[model samples]
Target: MSEEEEVELLLTELFDWYGYDFTNYSRASLKRRIIRLCSLDKFTSYVELRYRIRTDTDYLKRFVEEITVNVTEMFRDPLFYRTLRTDVIKNLAAKPFIRIWHAGCSTGEEVYSMAILLQEANLLQKSLLYATDLNPSVLEKARKGLFPLSQMKQYSENYIASGGAQDFSKYYTAHYGQAKFDTMLAEKMIFSMHNLVSDRSFNEFDLILCRNVLIYFDKNLQERVLKLFDDSVGPLGYLALGAKETLKFSSIQSKFKQLNKEKIWQKIR
Candidate 1:
């Protein structure tokens, strides 16, 4: 069999062994990540990689971290956060309290970004933010609320563009070339490991931000995940996707009204 066919069998075995269900992920990207992992670990072939995965649970956990998406930063798209603050937050403010889910919240930058926005809006005190990712390693870093000091400059710029003009430095203290954010924002967030491919939604949310995450999945998986998001959102709840993702062709497309065709969407039906 070809290497591609071996990958297919390996993915199935991976699911059966670890319950990750990577079978429906976009084949090209998943293969790339797997190949990258194999190369880094000095595996000569997928057969060797598969052997290690089947026998080494501890190594599998580490392997899972490498394959999953974790590239994220605070206020990733300034305009998206700008739109949330200007249009979405006010609608949420009318509520007695709010629940926001930051799905795929790698390293918690954008999750804290949302928390900071809510604090500025005087809504953080009344909000519960759920931040979830499939990787626990990143989640641990996120829970600590520290980011590299080198990143603070760019993050500050993003904060300003997202309509936060305050001294962004005031939010975190610098030590040993790293910036640790205050616990005030962390207090309102609950971080957990959640896999979109294999896990079901656990709660109804007023707003769900799974931004930039769906682009990695195949259309079938994206459709399933979109429907899952649809079911997880409460009536009139909002969803903010990546600039490149949309509900336009999904089965749940008509059920949601366009808040912003490329970014924000509202469940109307």
Candidate 2:
């Protein structure tokens, strides 16, 4: 059999064994990540890689990390956060409390960004942020709240551009080439495992941010996920997508009104 076919067979076996449904993921991306995993594990061939992944629990743990999305940074796309501050926050101020759902929050950078924004607006204490992802490994790292000190410089600039008024240094302490964020910022957050594809709506939220994730899904899966988000959001709540994603052609497009040309939408009903 061809190497590509062998890799596909291994992936199919993996899904059947672990119940991790990655069959619908983009093929090119999946193949690239799997090949990288094989190299990292020092496997000479896909057949050997499959054997190791099936027999070694540690190898399976690493496999999960390889398959999951872990790319994120604080205040990513400064304009989006700026828009939230200027538009969404202003409208939410009158509410006594707020609940935000950060779906597919890879490693909690966006979650922390939202916490900082709400804190600055004097709403952190009254808000609950639910940050969920399918991968438990990244969730653990996110819970720690420690990031490389080198990243802080750029992240600080992002904060300023996103309408931050205080010194970003106040939010974290530097130690041994790492910066650990304040625990108080994450105090009101509940980090947990949630799979958008298979999980049901558990709570109604004021704002649901599921950015950069749907791009990996097919149109049918995208529509299904959008409907789930719509059902999970409270009436007139905001739903934010990635810059390249939109609700325009989805089945539920008519149910929401575009808040901005940058992929922000709101449930009108």
Candidate 3:
């Protein structure tokens, strides 16, 4: 079979054997990642890769980790966080309770960043942050709230640019090569596994952040996920996407209005 045909067969086997679906992912991106995984694992042929995935449960976990996008950091796009602090958080503060969902929250840096934002605004006490990802391994990392100590300098700069005035180092303690974030920031967080391709909305949220994730999905899947977000967002709630992603021309475009130049869209209808 051709490489493309092999990919189709592999995706089918993964769904049938493991219940993880990548069939609806963006074809180009999925293929590239799959090919890269194959190369990184030194698979000489498609059959070897398929056999390993089919027979080895441990390898399956690695496969899932490799397939999903996990490139994330604290306070990504500082200006976006600034907008969230200035515009979105202020609106949410009016409510008695705030429910924020971080969909596709890979490793939880952004979630912690958000918790810090809420705490700074004195809203963390009344808020719950639900963070979900398809891969459980990343969730486990997120649960630990430990990040590489080497990255602290950049994250501190990001925290400052996001309008934070306090000492960012105060948020975590450094030991060995990792920085363990304060447990207080994690008290309000709920981490779980969720598949956007096949899962329904579980709760209505005041704000839903699914940054940089939809770009990996096909147009049909993108629309489906957008509708899911629309259904999950309360009236006047906000939906945030990545710098490259947008709701324009999607199934839920008419229901949301973009806030300035950022990718955050507020539900208007």
Candidate 4:
């Protein structure tokens, strides 16, 4: 069989046996990741990996991480965070309680970024942050709140560029080649494994962020997930996308108003 056909069948079996729904992910990108996985693990073909996942639960867990892992950093795209701080946070401060969901939040950098933002604004006490990803391994890393200390210099610059009011270094302590973020940032944050493709929205949120995530999905999955996000956000709530992602191609495009210079959108009740 051709490689394309093999991957299609692999995706099907992956869903049927493992309950993972990656069939609608962008075909080229998904194929690249899977092929890379096969190369890394010395599998002759995609079917070999699929067969292993079918028989070994541990292999399945690793496969999930291989495909879903994404690059992330604290206060990534600093300008976006700047816009959020100046434009979005002020509005959220008026709410008695705020719920924010960092959907597809790989490794929880942005989740911690949000916590620090709220903490500075004095809004952290009234806020609940849900940071979720499809892979449990990434969520575990997020829960630990440990990152490479070598990256602290760059992250600190990003924090300052993102309108951070205090010393970014104060948020984490460096030791043993790692930086462990303060516990207070994790206090109101909940980390969980949530598959955007197969899972339903769990709660209504004042803001939903799925940054740099949907670009991996096909149009159908993107629309499906956007609708799920739309339903999950309350009236007059906000949605933030990656710089390259937009509501222009979404099913609920007309319902949002782009308020800031960034990608944040408000659901026009």
lDDT of 2 by residue, 1-269 (tens): 88678867976897789766676677778788888887887888887888888899887878888887688899999999999998897788888889999999888999999999999999999999999998888899889888999999999999999889899999999989999999999898899989887789999999999999988877777888999998899988999999889988788889888876667887887
lDDT of 4 by residue, 74-182 (tens): 9999999988898888899999999999999888889999999999999999999999898888899999999999989999999999988798899999879999999
Top of the candidates by TM-score: 3
lDDT of each: 0.90, 0.88, 0.96, 0.91
Clashing pairs in 2: none
TM-score of 3: 0.99
Q: What is the lDDT of residue 166 in candidate 4?
A: 90
How would you encode candidate 3's per-residue C-alpha lDDT over 122-223 as one tens digit per residue? 999999999999999999999999999999999999999999999999999988899999999999999999999999999999999999999999999999
Candidate 2: lDDT over CA atoms? 0.88
Better of 2 and 4 by TM-score: 4
- By descending TM-score, how would the candidates be arranged? 3, 4, 1, 2
Worst 10 residues of 1 by lDDT: 256-265
Residue 253, candidate 2: how far off, in angstroms? 0.8
Instruction: Evaluate model 2: give its TM-score.
Output: 0.95
What does each candidate score in C-alpha RMSD?
1.2, 1.5, 0.7, 1.0
lDDT for 190 (candidate 4): 95
Highest lDDT: which candidate? 3
Indicate the worst ten consecutive residues by lDDT in candidate 4. Answer: 44-53
Model 4 regions lying over 4 Å from their true place: none
Model 1, residue 60: C-alpha shift (Å)? 1.2
Give the lDDT of residue 158 in candidate 4: 96
Candidate 1 structure, TM-score to reference: 0.97
